[model samples]
Target: MNETQRREQLKKIIEESEPISTGVALRYQGETKRVCVYRIPLDFLVYNKYNGRISSRVKAYERLNHELNSENDEDRELIEKLLWESKVERNRKTMEDLVENGQMRHGIVTADGVIIDGNRRASLLNRAYRERDKHKWSPVDVDKCRYFNAIILPQDAGPRDIQQLETTYQMGEDDKLDYNPIEKYLKVRDLTDVGFDIDEIAKMMNESTADIKKWQRTLVLMDEYLETLGYEDMYPMLDRVEDQFLSLSKGLKDWQDRSVLAKANWEYSDADIDDLKVIAFDYIRYEQEGKEFRRICKPGKEGSIFQDRLIWESFRDTHFETMDAIAEESVDEEIAHAHADIDVVDVLRARDSKWKSEISDSFKNNLKYSVRRLDDRMEDAKPKEILKKVRDLLKEIDTEQDSFLNDEGVATLVSEINRMTYRLKRELGQ
Candidate 1:
């Protein structure tokens, strides 16, 4: 519905329908006010594209595809699909509850009928009404599902307050849980983009100001990682790496602020940190995380390649060279040849598999060599422990292939290994 039509419709609904009473308390124009709830026809309301629950998904999808117009039926359907899928199992249970018990909690919408807090529930209501027969819903249940029970704000509601109220109410402790982690990060970014300060965002999200700043900083690094890999603004690539990014962002910040390691020799520059980001990005790209991912650059000498100048330079050069070589080939043909019914997610997954297959071993071997080199500098570290780690890495890789012999990096690394082995043998006086 257009703004004018919804305004007129809301006017009639407010005048004719008896309100269910003041059930919602909201912060409006810097004051707490209780708004009466009303039942409005579903047609008068539209899904909010920037709802925090799926904001990142919507953003990533729109960037990859096109902007969504909520007023358009096709676009509404697309938004509906995203909302439903954002938390599929939970949404399904909520839909079932709506069928059996009706809407227990009221939603908050603007006077012009844009839902501020109940996008998923609203989507589920619409879905339930559309598929009433499939669920064998009764006539009364179907009718009840047709109208949304919500607190409609005054017509003067501005976008700023609306967004703030939406953020506060939808994600409030008393409201729903199970939000996508990415949404919180992107929420801070979006609200910042629209001119909300960190304090304001923290208030709205019910998070501490420090945490809000941290999330924003982490989001910046995430964006840089995406842009570095030519996947700018595509957040689905970060599906399961939230924890890793948080650690990496903190690590990078620590190094930048310190310039030198806590107890190590090498001092780092901004350029060096950027190289570390790319190296971590590659490891993250190929399914490395936790201790393995942290060992790459966790801000200390104990297994960090950047702790020593030589290790840092060798690792960064080897990593970037391998990465550039991998990026030399185009995957557009393979993506284009995917099955017609294949989805973008699957296509991206296939591309990811292709990348991991081609680059993971090189990334791993280089990291292992660099890590061992760092350990070698630790005179207190046991040789047997380091050698055991090397043996494990060797067992995981096959060196007998003809392709291995042909690889210049592999040959050079093996030569270095032989030289080190000769030194150890001569020192033993065999």
Candidate 2:
């Protein structure tokens, strides 16, 4: 049929049926006495949001009947079928398998009523009930079910009581399905109680035997400190503790007593202990080789001995100036060359020899003139004064010659000459 005609036909069929029930009463038949049901159209049921309409009990039955005939399943089954066809089909399929294998259960109840128990089942049932007509719904068996025997509280119970009961039921009935190591441990614990071997449980949970055991140990260890450390801090330590436990050739207690694990005790804070644990393992593996830790030198710090030596060499080379000069007229070529040598003793000896030779040359040239001048002046006037002057001049020249021949005296003279030459060159800008 076209869209308009189909909608019209649905409306006509609904209008011709009895209205949905507000309140239902059971009546017994003769003998076998199957229950006869009837409806009361209270204001609450007349505007019911569940089925989107108010009618007699017969209309509710008709809706259930139509769903059963069309989907070929009972009310609960039809709801489940529709759920499987919805967006959360995969989760519903898992739930269906759990239900089939007696790992999960199903139920139904009023929205205002306390859940008491079987809260997960009730929630799933309610969702299926609401989504029965959606495109995603698919049929499944709902006959196999499990429920807790619970005492229903009075309608006058306070909201607090209802809320408390709901929370308790959810906690008690809902499977705490978290994909964490703790959750896996809990699951393994549950499985173990039912006679599953540790290996079998590990296989089922997709974990190694050692991994499972480590998790168990961690759970025990962390239980005492969980309140202090909290999950945020403790989670990353789980894998580290596992690795440490597995890597131990000896018992876990031995590993714990080892210096490595002892050193790790301070990492109980939100520190990344895994990286530290790996480092500890590496240290143990290569302990004989010695650990090499980097020493960071801060900026502007003085350098090492080798670096200081290099710097000193560079400074000495670029700043210190040494100069030597010799006059060819003052000393023989060999003596002058020797005077310019870095060795002070050799230069001093050479300078003394050169000075003696120069003094000898000066004395020989002036001695004859000095004696003749004295003789010529002797006969004139003041002959004694002329001879005394001449003798004094000769004595002064002889004194100079004797001093030049002395090593210490020659050394002093050369030093004075060097000083004067240096000063003169500096002033002349040469």
| Candidate 1 backbone collisions, by pair | none
Report the lDDT of model 2 for residue 3: 31
lDDT of 2 by residue, 1-430 (tens): 3334433433443346443332222111112212111111111110111110111121223432342331122543433333333225555655555445533332112223223333333334444434545634444533222222222233354433333333223322324231223334444444555565667556544557886677566455444332222222222223223333233222223334443333221222212222223322322222212111000000012111111223223322221211012233332344345534243324433454454454443333332343244234333547467657656764675445666667697678669967976886798799
Supply the TM-score for candidate 1: 0.88
**TM-score per model over all chains:** 0.88, 0.22
- Report the lDDT tens digits of candidate 1 across residue range 1-430: 7978988998889989999866467678789887789988899999899888777777767875789889999999989998888889989999989988989888888888899988888999999999999889888877788889988888788878787788787765655457877877887776787789989888888889999989989988899888876666677778889988987888788788884466557666788878888778878888787876777777654556667788788888888898778653343565467786665566676788888999978988897777767767766568787778777877877778977878899988889998998898898896
**Best of the candidates, TM-score:** 1
Model 1 spans > 4 angstroms off: 174-177, 300-303, 327-341, 382-430
Task: Locate the minimum summed-lDDT window of 10 residues in model 1.
Answer: 326-335
- lDDT against the true structure, per candidate, is 0.81, 0.34
